[model samples]
Target chain A: DAGITQSPRHKVTETGTPVTLRCHQTENHRYMYWYRQDPGHGLRLIHYSYGVKDTDKGEVSDGYSVSRSKTEDFLLTLESATSSQTSVYFCAIRDSGRGGELFFGEGSRLTVL
Target chain B: GQQVMQIPQYQHVQEGEDFTTYCNSSTTLSNIQWYKQRPGGHPVFLIQLVKSGEVKKQKRLTFQFGEAKKNSSLHITATQTTDVGTYFCAGGPTGAQKLVFGQGTRLTINP
Candidate 1:
């Protein structure tokens, strides 16, 4: 929780609706990632950004879109929410090393009806 | 598809017992990190292993990276009730920012 805060920590939305989750970090870390965890599936990456406006797809990016317009802000959008999209989403920032540890924000729990 | 697999999906032991979790990556990892997540809590960073055949210790926790650099392990000696949580291992591939995580090993201590 150090510098990472996720907005709308808990959400309930209807299927086919558009929803966006916001992640803001005060640490100004260059690497930010969005991961969704479901029961028994561990944490699957949805999207990640290495720099402003530089984003890439993760393992499960089919229904998720991410935008990083600023250093501290990363937004993940579900173009159209679905029941299967319901899960706990976490925002993480990487430490500066060849490949360092991640500091995670409190996760966002989303429920799609 | 890089696979990071963790062994002993669940571990239950008496207080003061030792515990260990193993993580193996299908591909060689640039580095590996271990995290501990309490029930209903986000993961907290525990340690990072960068060099092959490297071993580090923190209090009762010992972390090691295999000489092949494709596997790692976390061993806790004389565990306590406070150590109840899920232990996760994440691996980062060379030139990649994504830290793909293993399924995690949940540890339970019987007090």
Candidate 2:
């Protein structure tokens, strides 16, 4: 198993509030991703970083922002929480190593009222 | 943006039965990957298929990529009670940095 951990394991915030989720990896992988999972929607990418200060937007990137100032930590923030943004957020990492397996963090469940 | 369509939305089978789900991409994909998420668990990597017409297997599960590189399938034999979860297929284009996951197929196994 890969060493990945997510902070704020669970959170509940009211609408229009700002929330930030943290993702930390012990392996120092070069690639990191943020995704959201909702019922019947599978997982949708929110943002990803290939290296420190190198980030890209994903399909559902609106209303969210990400920053990776270091190799082991990635941060995602929701500017103003909304009911539609309530979902389980996951942090995943993959690098050119050990047969191309993508490891995931336990995930953070967020609920916006 | 890339998209994948997976089906059937949900499936239920008795232990020892067979199960299968498919993923179809709207455009040609450079590679396809599979993931499984147990109840209340995060999505875990299952396998990745990078070549057209490629096939790979692990224990009772088999994965296949279509020759056109726009579709894939996963079949599980002799389903067990532990086979309950959602299976997702993700695809990425060549030189693409992010992966797009399908809607996923939820599986339920009965004893």
Candidate 3:
């Protein structure tokens, strides 16, 4: 149970609509990551931020964008939703002081129609 | 692109039976970590193995890292209903900040 919270725990949006999921953390960890979980595909990294305003794309960053303007909040945005994007999104913070173990949020379930 | 491949997408076993899952990586890994996710819950870290040919045990669960640093396995003894979940193996490549996760193996137990 990390001090991580994901806004909009569950969301359903129509195709081609703009959607954004927010992740907020109080742990003050330097690394934050956005991951999407799909059945049979495990968890795929979408984007990650090492510090304020510092971000990098992951393996499955296509059609998605992320912003980390502050150390406590990281945002993942899907400019136009698609059915293919429907999945459970999870936000995680890495404790670099340790062995880089990740503490994940409860997750946000998004359904695109 | 480093890839971690896990086998046996799903498994069904009766209570008290044993279960195992295997993971292989396309490249050498600096470390390997294991996580378990119960149904409808987020994944939780279980353990990590950093040395080649390393083996660690936690209660009834055992984790092994291959000698080549490119493979790992998790074995659980006497499975129970509480052991039902998806197990994922994530590999951290050398000098990489991110981990590449396998597809995961879902374990279902009949009590």
**Pick by TM-score: 1 or 2, better one:** 2
DockQ values of all predictions:
0.87, 0.84, 0.89
Candidates sorted by DockQ, best first: 3, 1, 2
Model 1 spans with C-alpha error above 4 angstroms:
A97-99
Tell me the tens digit of each residue's lDDT in model 1 across A1-113: 57999989999999999999999999878899999988777888999999999999999999899999999999999999999999999999976753467999999999999
Cα shift from native, residue B98, model 2 (Å)? 1.0
* lDDT per residue as tens, model 3, A29-98: 9999999999999999999999999999999999999999999999999999999999999999997889
Predicted model with the maximum lDDT: 3
**Model 2, range B1-111, lDDT digits (tens) per residue?**
577999999999999999999999999998999999999998899999998999999999999999999999999999998889999999888877678889999999989
RMSD to the native, candidate 3?
Answer: 0.7
Candidate number that wins on TM-score, 1 or 3: 3
Judged by DockQ cut-offs, is candidate 1 incorrect, acceptable, medium or high? high
lDDT of candidate 1 over B1-111, digit per residue (tens)? 999999889999999999999999999999899999999999999988889999999999999999989999999999999999999999978776788899999999999
User: Residue A93 in candidate 1 has what lDDT?
Assistant: 91
Model 2 docking grade = high
Error of 3 at B17 (Å): 0.6
The local distance difference test score of each candidate is 0.93, 0.93, 0.96
